[model samples]
Target: MAVIPATWDMYDLIQGVLQAPWYHMVFEVALVLLIVKIYISQSFSPEKTVLTDKEKETLVEEWVPEPLAPDVPDDHPILKSMEKYCIEGQNGKYVTVNGKSCINLASFNFLSMVGKKEIEDEALKALKVYGVGSCGPRGFYGTMDVHLHLEDDLAKFMNCEEAILYSYGFATIASAIPAYSKRGDIIYADENVGFAVQKGLTASRSHIRWFRHNDMEHLESLLIEQEKLDKKNPKKAKVTRRFIVVEGLYLNSGDICPLPKLVELKWKYKVRIFLEEAMSFGVLGQTGRGVTEHFEISPDHIDLIAASLETAIASTGGFCCGKKFIIDHQRLSGLGYCFSASQPPMLASAALQALKMLESKPRILVDLRENCERFHQKLMNMPGVKVIGDPISPIKHLMLAEPAGDPGLDVRTLEMVVDNAMNDGVALTVSRYLEPEEHLPKDPSIRLSVNCELTHEEIDRSADIISQSFQAVLGKLTTRSLDVSSPLNSVQQDNRSLKASR
Candidate 1:
């Protein structure tokens, strides 16, 4: 309120103009006006009109509709089969399906421990203690002490330096492959390897050379080709790793890989060997040590072995066995291991129980081997059915002695036979394949799985039922219908002259 310096007032009341010392005040006024102009323009500018919650939802729904999966028709063969043969409760040597207890030739309970009281009790104990799911991956407090114990049990069981568990059987080899093999690496795989193996190879983005199924000669030729390629580019060969991928027991064909030859090639070519033992782990060998034990080869020769516990072990999940360096790498580098939750503690506990049970009862392996051989011999005597697999293989494919000219007809015939067998209280499966995806499509057949619990009576009954079913179905059709071009081929007489008999 100090009234002074009125002389500093630079205003022209009469002329409405004049400023020099008060230039700062004028500049400030201009700055305030500019800010007001900017605020006015922005405050009223047209952006999109804001939508209400319901309007926003409607717009989103219209713009991005939820997708529906392709419908599988009710009349689909697979669905029809499922509807006809719905197994209730646990699968075992004898499974209850559609209210009938039938001899099971369709289950994977090779060692017959699926519903054992001891294993169930052990699983329940773990379930109560650790709950159901592992809930997260190994590093995230998902892994339990039971999982570690099971890993150790598996490692020791396989006679390997270490082992790692996968929450899923399919993902075991899938994760193991890409963990080591990458783009630019070369993988030599069998033409009949399972779809999971194909997926792993595909994901690795490696250069894959496929050999004929279980053919050592073709594999050696591929190796020789690789050797020649190496000679051509020693520098690239030095940096590039070569891997030989094979199945211990080919799931598609039921034949074991020629391991000794593969091992020889592995050393001769300096390539790593990765064997997927999903089908053979608990079914092969005098002591069930798998293909390695069956052939008297050391597990050390193979770089890694991936197998599922679902087979002979009769449990959930899978595992990889090898020296510590290889398996430990999977812990961090394998996407399946790093991304999927740790296997349920209950499953790990049951697997551990099964492993221990198998160890204690070495005779279980002996029984399985004998049962497989017995079943194979029975199937061999079967007519109109060509048994395609190793004599000792627990999994065997009984293909048509002569293929029906039409693939669809052949499948329908096999499916009919399967239905007939099931009706007679013999549970059988017609082997299925995603033919479009298989490297070499497997021939249609009735797949038979032999379990240790099967007695001589059960085996004989199953074999008899299968043979009868085949005879019932195939005997109705003419050799001509089956497209048989045997010595009885007719000529110039047209279609009518093809004789049935006099």
Candidate 2:
């Protein structure tokens, strides 16, 4: 509008040229040519381009490349060494990779309820009633009637005043750790706490110290150190509250917490204790009430009792149950409780049913514990194996030799062991210690979790598979010198196995 500059004259010149006779003629011709082209290629027209069923089949046949299956390498040391544990499942027995099925020794179905018709029927009914998802976060619209019912049932079953649920066991730890402690709090935890709990603690920016796993003396020393610090910094500190956390049972070594001694320490030091009973809930104690009851202690002694519904409950979710005040405080304080999505209705329903069954029929707990003991006895009797933890708990672990402080097994080798058992129709989790030092008998060690569902025969067979797997992977190394290096060298021979182990 303000008299365009000479440099802008190019715009007008182009506009004038485009508006000339030739431009219009070309545009008209181009439009006609496009129409003709589209008419000639009617198969590719917008209205007709999609393929018919016959054409799609023909194209698929013509264009799809054959899938090349992965080949197992010949002369592979791992294959040669792991041959025994390379098993498959068949006829209800866990089979070797060569297809010899034996009794299953590896399954997490603790109550042996997963494949039951009644359980399936209940699950189906719940699914039909609640659909597949909760469709929203618990803080918004996710909490259904089922969620509340399960929470209430769990609290009652655990003999606690309150309980809060999370999507999974680890999620509970991740959400709860940071929620309770802060920058200035001192968190004294057992070395065996799960990774998720550590993550939570790390996020909370608290001063963290690790006591030896289940070592009451070490815990006392840590408590003394924290007390000394507290007295030293009485006037100028960030915030206060000493949190002592440990697992009710150690998953790696299949061991239980020293509840009496730990509780005593807590009483003397006046420090709070958080026990993650991922494996112990619904299985330990006289009434299936867990370590709190097993030790004849009340919920007041336990500042927090965190557990995964994935284990004994035969469902998916996690919860922390304790005193109403602590539970309520944690509800607001835990990010998982306040922010994360709650468990779905079907899972809640199933968990509630499982909890009710565990509570009313205490026989289930007895059966599970008996099954665990049976398995422990069977495995410990086997050649080249050492069993850890209380024989009565369903957490029998076969400790193996590491050879010169070298941890002999890793995730992949363990996975191979799992695969071998799975191929044989048994499903079990292989727990490899995070550190070689931890695998010491006095320290943490590699472990396998046993539950009640397995029969005596199944336990015997599983022990066989485990021993075979260890022997297959570890060769002739003695379980005693697993504290040495032979097993490490054996594992190192197979590069792929080594990589997988990590």
Candidate 3:
């Protein structure tokens, strides 16, 4: 009811509290009932019971994992057999692991060039001249003489007009790629390109498409699709450019890029191509000039060749090389180039020396190839092993196909292989590529790298240890069944088995 100023006294006289007490009581009882109903409704009711007690018990039993204490005992046959490859301190021939001496096949030091006397002396001199680190980002104030020298040396070695450096190998992909394209661009990536490269492309706010692992046909198809899209929209037609990105060698399968096919594709579409030569640069080609050189294709054939000097050159940092306009454009336009810090003077100088060394004596690359071939043949000859990749590259993969249900087999098997190799006085980093992905099995495989400095005897010793590890794993697999077919045999048969012309 409305109260007027004239009826104020009458309103105050009315029993409003008494009039609302019954309604207030009803509302309170309704709220209490509603809360109770909600609490009961959300609980595990009879209607929600999908299983009987007996079935529930069985499901619980199935979900429970097997006891690890019994299978992984200290005196376990698997553990006792794998301790022969351990080493104490890695020198020219061996490395130290868990207070023991062992031959090392696990390092990425392809040329075994990191600890050389002359290179070390040069690194020391640069340290004295330019101090330990760059004071700021390259774009702001850190570019130095050694930095320029390294870029020049890399340009000459890769046979490009110019080259630019990045402090980290992975950052180069992440930073440079997104800057090249925009919302209207179409990116076609390799199936097995490095995760960093894929991640960079995926992170881009632009549209991207993927091709099958080294499938040139799929790449061409995707390019055709992009053309259709471009033709439909005048806006996209003006800005949409196709870019094909891939690695020189896939880290997972140790498969080398089919450079000739890729080059042909580049010419067909007149699109840009970015090739990551991280694992192939210092290990392939006649003069270790990388895939382009291995195929006898000129640098002009490739729009861009990106690589990490740390892998084969025995130095730290990464570089991208290409034509003058391309290099200059990236230097000014690429966020990674404009924002990242320059390579340290010492690291830059070390890279320069490594490039010169590689050029002056081509024997290092040849020796590296020979070492790779030796290891691959020896491993393949052994019972129950598959060697992945071309015979020319130092990277090789040894996979285990059996013992299916062990969830930790991927890590455990790698640890077993690495641990056993170390005990036999052999050092090798177990391949981690396949194990980490959900798409891959728990017991993936092992990866081996034959350093340029490895001698025949060292290779034989490595073979023996690898054989021992395989024997141990095979014995462990006695409890289960395995399907073993080498991936290398498939790769070899599928594409014309063209021998890498060295």
Candidate 4:
């Protein structure tokens, strides 16, 4: 009864306040004004403009059509200098380029399994059964038993709960990132990560923080900063997922990441780690288990691992390995997996066979490591060049010791050296990148990929050819400066000139 009286008292108080004449009159006037506003809006909208046929034609004719992409000039540097060399057949320790058989230091056949009989037999069998293409995405009648078997094999080999396969190697990490990460999340990545990783980070739409290449102290500082930010907004931080993205072996730099330190930081900061092992998966570790195994760190500490099969497996497509729950989510959420056709069963079979071979013959990894070290040492002896990468890394970049200071000039010089090397029956490639798009653009250099089948004599010969090529090209490099309008004719010139047209 007392509660009822209090409620009545409140009601009476409100009534007394509303009893004033102005309050009622003001309420009525405001309601009337709102009604008038709505009426005015409904009664008065701008009329749509219409044009006659003649007028429309005139307008269309007056407007110039624009090109979808900018045009390249006849003298575009890359086009003018680029030479197309056709490869005759299979990739092995030696491959034929333009009908010339050369030491295959240019291909990514790290495990020397490209021409194996067992892998070819497996591929032939799959081709007989599944044909060339899957013809549909995984969800739409494209998944084959071979695909499932490969996934299972990969999961077991990587010691992960499950795995997901992507039709394209480039899209594996690119799609996996946006599948889990979104606008509000944050990704801390190495500045020197490959272009594929750069693409993934861009697609994720997450805030990215870049640390110096392979600098743990810089990474730790960024973590500390993020921790302090989380403290300020604990509620928001609870929902925001932080990830540290890095490559086990950098495709751009060819140096191995310090996995032990990254794992320690992952624990200290409570951030998940996503490791890309495209270049290291079958080229590192004692049995080619990759960087984690090389550093004796357990894969359980890492959240996800993505790698392309093209490198060591000598096949197409790629795969991501992680917990079952996470891998399963990509089936529905990953754009590449959901919309793109599944990988050809033949490639999967080839990759499976290759993986089996790697598991059985761990000696290949030993041979590959020895070859890499030998190549690295010999490359260092080459004049006018500096090797960038670890001794055990399958990939190495040979940069100019004294660059001409311009990337365009340096690229041309390196290309000249590559051409010379190719003529000498040693295939080589200049490291190429979309310079404008790189997070931290690397200088132009000759990128060399090591093959386990390369003999010590071949390694020495390749190194000698590279040195001779550099000495020849640099000797011819020249520059000239003259004052054509001078009252008294004068000229200045140097033997080294990258500014002059070739």
Candidate 2 per-residue lDDT over residues 1-502, each given as its tens digit = 6887996789888888778899787998999999999889847446558789999899988996656986767854455546645554331223244555444444445665554455557778889998988877777888898888878888877778988889867888777777778887889987767666677778889988888878889889888877787788876543588888887776655678888888788889888888888877777888877888888888778888888888767778899888888777876778777776778787787777777677678887787778777776776765544667788766655554342333334444555555555555455555533342342333323455565656676677667776676666555333423543565455555645656798
Q: Write the per-residue lDDT of candidate 3 for residues 70-157, one digit (tens) a residue.
A: 5556854345545543334434445666777666666778887767787888999999999998967787888998888788888877
Model 2 poorest 10 in a row by lDDT: 436-445
Query: What's model 4's TM-score?
Result: 0.88
TM-score of each: 0.83, 0.70, 0.74, 0.88
Evaluate all candidate structures by whole-model CA lDDT and list the values in order: 0.87, 0.70, 0.74, 0.88
> For model 4, what is the error of residue 386's alpha carbon versus the real structure, in angstroms, after optimal superposition?
1.0
Candidate closest to the true structure, highest TM-score:
4
Superposed Cα deviation of residue 2, candidate 2 (Å): 69
| Model 3, TM vs. native | 0.74
What is the per-residue lDDT of model 4 for residues 137-209, given as tens digits with 9 covering 90 to 100? Answer: 9999999999999999999998889999998998999888888889999999999998888899999999999
Q: What is the lDDT of residue 374 in candidate 1?
A: 96
Error of 1 at 267 (Å): 0.7
Alpha-carbon error at 499 in model 3, in Å? 43
Question: Comparing candidate 1 with candidate 2, which one achieves the higher TM-score?
Answer: 1
What's model 2's lDDT at 28? 85
Judging by lDDT against the true structure, name the best candidate.
Answer: 4
